[model samples]
Target: MVSPHVQDELRIFFTSLALGACMRETLAEWRPVVDEAIADLVPREIDTEYLESFFGEPTYAYDPDGLQRALSDPLWDLLDRGGKRWRAVLFLVFVEGFGEDPMAYLPYACIPEILHNGTIIVDDVEDGATKRRGEPALHHIYGRDVALNAGNALYFLPLKILTEDPGNLPAEQRLAAYEMLMDELNRTHLGQGMDICWHNEREVRITPAEYLEMCACKTGCLGRIVARLAAIITDQPERVERAAATYAELTAVAFQIGDDILDVENSLGRAGEFGKEFGNDVREGKKTLLVIHAIEESPPETATRLQEILEAETNTDDELAEALSIIEDAGSIEYAREHALELAADARAAVDELALDAETTDRLYTFTEFVVDRDV
Candidate 1:
């Protein structure tokens, strides 16, 4: 069960989104207003004509049926599914921290969310995931071929927006931002590749340090990009921007570890609420911090058994339950929870290094706690 304080924090976050103070809602109730605003930035029609007319036809003829709908519809469907909007919110919060109007960066704020959701669509297909956010995976509904094309299209959408002058940012700064985005994308893919490779290999043992590094690249890259973008828009000093980016990276590590712990606890019934099966990480043989710690700390025989279960092609319900028992018996769950708190504290410390107002610093600290403590 969620504590009252955590519940209140979630309430405020969602309330902010609903009031259009943080996010542009795409729900049916707010669709008209939100769609109008988004249309100004992302057009309804995403046709090859724009590409051909703007950049000339490619060397090879390229076409897809219902190109516009194929590209935009799936994106809208996923976005409208609802999320915490954490990255976008963090971008705005940092903008406000720098004494600028948060609303001014709204269009650019959509960049993180678009990139994140696009990645999720692809991740689901790659991981053979059955559900996402309590609904069937995008590929499950739209089919893999169409979903892959749509996901790829969404990845480039942000770049197209950056090339434009929506933020009215200087050309040099825009170029710098584009470079930063590319850098983070490369890091994210590298981290994902490592994870995919590890899962496919047999009898592999990953150290806790390696697992943390992977999380930094896979998850931290998202946070770093938004924090860096905030610094860019605010025109802060390089040192201050680096500090903020570091804080964001630490926060991402805590967030991912917290998620790992939740997968084991399964206390919130995430399978229903988050569209992730209970213990899916174990089933996929994910090298989460908890799994690493449990294996390293367990008896030699027990460790071998744990690894064997993880490497199995499939496990019965009883086998999965026993694995959970082993992890708990090894006390890895509590260890992970305590470690997440430590990471969150470190993230808060990094925030203090930023030269923001007292109130913004306090809010950022609170947000770091929220990142780790959230139930969903």
Candidate 2:
């Protein structure tokens, strides 16, 4: 466990990163907007291009198959229209702190985020998720087939970027980075597959452990790999990789758990509206930690009612209300929140073990806390 003073020191350190002279200079000309806050802090034109292109006006090659148009059209609008790019920025920040030029790793830095964005585009369709970033989903805007192709294109963007000689990184290092990236990609897809299959089949009962496992794959793995890659960029591959991976694993679980809790409470802003009907997870028989815990802790009658609600062909407002009531009565939300807090604690400890520069260590630790505690 990390000592309280150490944890507090780490927090102070990260807080300082926001206001430090170095960061101030870095942040000086850059303004923080919803779309480009992360990009603002970066020093390079290409970094900005990479960031903005994803968020702003992005056009790709033309093809009658619509592959180019579909894949290229909504990406910048979709990515730039929303999201903090916190994960990508975190990678760059840490890379800078390690005395490496962040520009050297720009290609690698944005890959995970691009992959994440790609998944979101596809997932909105798969999950029938409607709203994104406070707007209609790409599928809703462009139609499903185009939206799917657009996501596929975003998914491939990283590959092209990775193979480029942007940083002149050694072939061995590039290969290692690619391997790590592929691993994360595999996990993310696997987790998504399970999530979608569970939604469709409704036969596999979920336990908290299973939910965590899924979260680790779908969310945690990529986050961890990003951190690990940062370490690799900094040339302290082993220690940083282990530390970042540990932090990523814990934070990812906390992130997904928090998302689940938000889903239940309807507190997730645009993403909340995108929800598959209200209480659609239950209606679709998706197994989430909240539902699993609620089932375990609620009264038998409440459990039966919950199952009936889930097993029903569709969920009415009354059924949704009843399910929410049962979940509240069982204190599942509180339990889930506590679990997230615990994971945050684990993340702090994990980073503390690394022999990172004071600033990097502090920022990484603080970032984890922010993720665990973020309202949105």
Candidate 3:
């Protein structure tokens, strides 16, 4: 017989494992269809490596020598540091739910993955990020120009993948899909712009509402695009659009708050650190929701100290510690955590209105939980 504590622990672990396995299976069910669709274009001789090499193009006339060096460079290796194939997975999820052939939207699925990579490349540059997936950043290893162009090269891949002669798709469907892709592209750019603006204007003061608006522009919009594009492919554009928008808003807010929390809780080496000599956000003076709320709620002396530290040209470790103390004592961390939970709950409710098939809906539900519960 097991002790009560051990039994409870085991039960929780198994439950989590089961949920993960279900999501894995749901993603797996679509792989064959995706593979077949990709195979339709890329010969069996081609693999992910060759695709990465092709993505890193040069500015000058092709010198096979220089081209080979650039292509073979390790800087582009982030392409292989795979995740859940989430964006592609979402694309196919929507396709399957609409009772459409999974193969039909495999090409469209490539759009999100490509765009996602493009953003990461540019983001690393903007953030001056040193590491990606435990490896040197592309900008760090390849230099800014190559990194920029390589990212730019990826921008066109989605078009190449998506517009690949729609073969059997009706002209109307094909046009509709392309339009959806364009809209997502525009929305994502707007979000990226907001993120960049926030990064550059480090001293800007913002309220929680303003911070949410920035997220809607910077992070939430892309997420909205992710689900809505899936709906477009599935041809359930109207019903899924609002659901996608709502999920994107909540998830984005939670994600940013979690990021700020991690900046405080985790060590700098973990990529949670935004690269300041100390608390990056504090040092750079980026206005995050937590910082704003903490200032608002702090006692007069604590607020003055935080303001002084934020305005300092440099903050020492002691200053960083003191600032964090103020933030925590002001209850900003707990506030952010509760807000994330509330938004996540709202996002879950929004999904209930969709007429998704049982398995897909369950996978989506699991995905929402995973998003909020994520540790990294």
Measured on C-alpha atoms, candidate 2 has an lDDT of: 0.69
> Against the true structure, whose TM-score is highest?
1
TM-scores for the candidates: 0.84, 0.78, 0.77
**Residue 273 miss distance in model 2 (angstroms):** 15
Give the whole-model CA lDDT for all candidates, comma-separated.
Answer: 0.76, 0.69, 0.65
Ranking by lDDT: 1, 2, 3
Candidate 2 off by > 4 Å: 1-17, 20-68, 266-285
Please, what are the lDDT tens digits per residue for candidate 1 over residues 34-114?
Answer: 333344445566566665653457799646347655776677778767765667677867888888866566667767767
Q: For candidate 3, lDDT tens digit of each residue in 152-200? A: 7656655665455453556676676677667767766776777677656
Steric collisions counted per model: 0, 2, 1
lDDT of 3: 0.65
For candidate 3, the clash count comes to: 1
Residue 302 in candidate 3 has what lDDT? 80
In the predicted model 3, the residue pairs found to clash are: 191-217
Question: What value of lDDT does candidate 1 attain over all alpha carbons?
Answer: 0.76
Locate the minimum summed-lDDT window of 10 residues in model 1.
22-31
